[model samples]
Target: MSRYFPHPAYAEDQPLARTILITHVGTRAITTGTIIGAGIFGTREALRRLRKAAAPSTVTASRSQLYLRVAGHSTLWTIGIVSLGLAGRMWGREEIEWQDRSWRLMENEAQLQTDDWTYGGMVAGLAATALFKRPVGWVAAVGSVGAGSVAGTLGYLGWRYGLQRREPPISE
Candidate 1:
C-alpha cells in the first residue's frame, strides 16, 4: 500500500510544498503592502488634487472652513482606504487558498514549471508598476497585474484539475 500510495511521503520530502507555502506568504505580504501604500499615497494625492481645485480665496479661507475641508477630505480618504484594503485582503486570501489547493492536487511537473514562469512575469509587472510616481498610475498598474496573474493562475489550475479528473483512474 505504501508503494502504491507514496504521495504522502513524497510530499513531505518535496521542497515544492514548502516553496508554495512561502509563495502564499509572499502573496499576502505583497497584497498588504500594496493596499497600505496605495491608501496612504492615494489619500495624499486626493487631498492635493482637492486643494488644487479650490478657489484661491478658499485656500486662504477662515480657519474653521479650512478645518472643515480637511475633515471632510480625511473622512473620505479613510473610507476609501478601508474599503480597498478589505477587498484586497479578501481577494488575496481566496487566491492563496485556491493556489494552495491546486498545487496540492497537481501532479504535472510541466504545469509547475509553467507556474514558475507565470509567477515571474507577475513579479516583473509589479516592479514595473512600482516605478510609477503617480498614485493613480501605480494603482492601475498594480491592479491590472494582480488581476491578470490571479486570472491566469486560476485558469491554469482549472485546466489541470479538469484534465486530471477526466483521466481514467489507475487500478493496480
Candidate 2:
C-alpha cells in the first residue's frame, strides 16, 4: 500500500518549520530560566513584603496571604512566558523570509554579529529597567531593546549590501 503522508526526510528539509520550532523552544527555555531565577533571588523579599503589607490577624492568615501572592506572581509569569513564546514563533516567520531571500544566513558571521548586538541591547535594557525602578524605567528599557534590535537589523542589511557591491563581476 502506498503511504498517504510525505516521508520524514521531506519534513526535515523544511527550514522554516525548524527555525520556528527552535525559536519556540529557546523562548520557553529563557522564560522558564528567568522565572526560576527571579523566584530564587526575590522570594524572600516578596514574602516579607506580603507579610508586612497584610498585617494578618494570625500566623495562618499571613501564610495564606503569602501563598496567594506567590500564586498570583506565578500565574503572571506563566502568562508572560506563553506570550513571549508566541511572539517568538511569529518572529521566526519573518526570519525565515530573510533567510529565503538571502538577507541573512543561519550560520554566518553577519548573523552572529547581529545576534550579539540584539542580545546586548536586551541585557542593557533589562539592567536599566531593574536599576531605575518603575514608570519611566520600564518604558525606557523596552525602547532600548527595540532600538537595539532595529539597529542590529539595519547594520546587517548594510553589511550584506556593501559586500555585494564590492564583489567583482564575473567575466563570461
Candidate 3:
C-alpha cells in the first residue's frame, strides 16, 4: 500500500514510538486483516449470487470492474485506505507524547476487541444467509452488519467495561 508523507520538517512527530514499532506494526497488521477478512468472504458470496442470477445461469458472466461499486464492495476499499494510514504512521522517528500514547494504546485495544466481535458476527451472518444453496440478499446483507454489530458490540462493551471497572479477584 502506497502512502503520502510530507517532508520530515513539515510534520511534528510520528505516531508510533520508533523503537517499539515491531510490536505495534504487527498488531496493526493483524487488526487490519481482521477487518478485511470479515468483509471479503461476504463480498465473494455476493458475487457468486450476482453471477448465478445472470442469464444462461451456470455459464458465468464476464466480470465487471464496476460490479464492486454496484454491489457495495467499496466499503472494503475505504477500510483498506484507513488501514494503510495506520500502517504508514509507524515509519517516522519522532514519538507520540506519553499522554497521547496512552490514549492511542487504549483506542487500539478497543478497536481490536471490536474487530473480534464484528468478525464473529460477520461469519455467523454469512452462514445464516445461505438458503437453498443460495445467498439471501438485500435487507439480509445489510442486517448482517447491523444486527450483529449491535449484539456483538453490546457484549464486547460489557466485557471491556467490567474489566476496566472492577479489580481482579484475589485467589487466596
Candidate 4:
C-alpha cells in the first residue's frame, strides 16, 4: 500500500477551544504588561534604597539595619509578589491542563497557547524594563503584576469553565 498522511484530529468544539486559548494568552499578556509597570516602580525604589544604603552615613549602621535599609518595604513587597506570582504559575499548570482536557483541545493548540502566553509575558516584562529608563525595579514590579494576573486569570478560568460543565458545540 502507498504511504499516506494521517488525518489531524480537531477539537470537538472549535469555538470553545479557541476562546479558551485566546483568553489564556491574552490574560498572560495583559498581566505581564501590568507587572512590568509595577516592576518599573519597584526597581526605582530598590535602586534608591541601594544608593542610600551605600552612602557614608549609613556605612556604620548594623548589619540588620543595613539589610533593612537596602531592602525597604517596597523592595520587599516587590520580591514577595514576584516570588508568589512565579509560584502561582507553577500551581496553575494543573488547572490549565484540566481546562484543555475539558474542552477536548488538541496538543498543538494547547502548546501554541502556552507558547504565546510565555512569549507575551516575556516581552511585556522586558518592555516595561525598557520603558522606565532601564531601571532594575522591573524585576519586582513585573513579578508582582504577573503574580496578580495569574491568580486572577486562573481563578476566573477554573471558576467559569471547570466549575460549570458546558456542552461542546454540535458538529455538523
Question: Once superposed on the true structure, which residue ranges of model 4 sit more than 4 Å away at CA?
Answer: 1-12, 53-172
The candidate scoring highest on lDDT is: 1
Against the true structure, candidate 2 has what lDDT? 0.44
TM-score of each: 0.32, 0.30, 0.33, 0.28
Model 3 TM-score, 2 decimals: 0.33
Computed on alpha carbons, the lDDT of every model, listed in order, comes to 0.46, 0.44, 0.44, 0.45
Best by TM-score: 3
Over the stretch 94-162, how does candidate 4's per-residue lDDT look in tens digits?
Answer: 554534553543443333444444444445544443443323453344443354444454554554467
Q: In candidate 2, what are the lDDT values of residues 1-172, reduced to their tens digit?
A: 0011122233323345444344434433433433443464367667869788754466543332343334334434654677676567556465545333222233334444555554554465445435433333333334434334444445555665765554323434
Candidate 3 or 1, higher lDDT: 1
Clash totals for all models, in order?
0, 0, 0, 8
**lDDT rank, highest first?**
1, 4, 3, 2
TM-score attained by model 2: 0.30
Ranking by TM-score: 3, 1, 2, 4
